[model samples]
Target: DTAVSQTPKYLVTQMGNDKSIKCEQNLGHDTMYWYKQDSKKFLKIMFSYNNKELIINETVPNRFSPKSPDKAHLNLHINSLELGDSAVYFCASSRRGSGNTIYFGEGSWLTVV
Candidate 1:
């Protein structure tokens, strides 16, 4: 069984369009995160949730929103997508206070035209 899973592994959309990526973790972790990998492969944390509570929210644009309906599920929604928004979105999970040990999903590749 996959520890972390996300839907729509690849997405191609036009600018100004809205889209969403759904993620789930079956590892029973208390913390989950949304990470973005840019063109240069520089990874940055976008949002984090612990037991369905908002925790770490990075300095991302208001267009990017993360919603966690439960500790095991966290979804990312992007409004008015822009070309610069093209990147790999990774869903990750880790035990609270586990210190750097994180399990990542296969990643959702989004391309904006």
Candidate 2:
């Protein structure tokens, strides 16, 4: 079983459309996160959750939201998608205080046209 899994590995949509990427972790982690890697491959943290509580939130637009229904799932929803939103979104999970042993999913590639 995959430790972390995300759906729709690739996505292409028109600008102004709304989209979502679903993620799940079976590793029983206490923390989950959403990270974005731009075309330049510079990775950045968009949001983070610890046991369903919002922890770290970076300077991202309000159009993006991270929803966690439970500790095992974290979903990323984007509204009014823009061309600049195109990138690989990664879902990761880790046990808090584990010292850098986070597991990541395959990543959802979103391309807004």
Candidate 3:
């Protein structure tokens, strides 16, 4: 079975539209995260959830929200999408902290026109 999976590997929408991306993991890991990789390839954490609790990165905009239905799933919702928001969103899972290796999904590419 796939350890982690995300829907709509590619998304193209006009600016100001809202979009949501779903992610699921079967690794039984307690910690899950949403990351945005910009055009420069800089990966930055947007949100982290463990046991249904959220730990958000300060740099992330209020337009981005992360929802975790359970330990196995974490989804991202974006509102008022802007041209600057066009980037690759990746769902990842890890045990916790810096000790564990973060495993990433294939990534969902979002393009805001």
Query: Which candidate number has the best lDDT?
Result: 1
Local distance difference test, each candidate? 0.96, 0.95, 0.91
Query: How well does each candidate superpose onto the true structure, as a TM-score?
Result: 0.97, 0.97, 0.95
Candidate 2 residue-wise lDDT, 63-91, digit = tens: 99999999999999999999999999999
Candidate 1: segments with Cα more than 4 A from true spot: 98-100
Clashes of 1: 0
Residue 15, model 2, lDDT: 100
Whichever of 2 and 3 has more lDDT, that candidate is: 2
Question: lDDT per residue, candidate 3, 1-113, as tens digits?
Answer: 88989988999999999999999998989999998899999999888998889865657889998889898999999999999999999999988777899999989999999
Better model by lDDT, 1 or 2?
1
Which clashing pairs does model 2 show?
none
User: Candidates 1 and 3: which is better by TM-score?
Assistant: 1
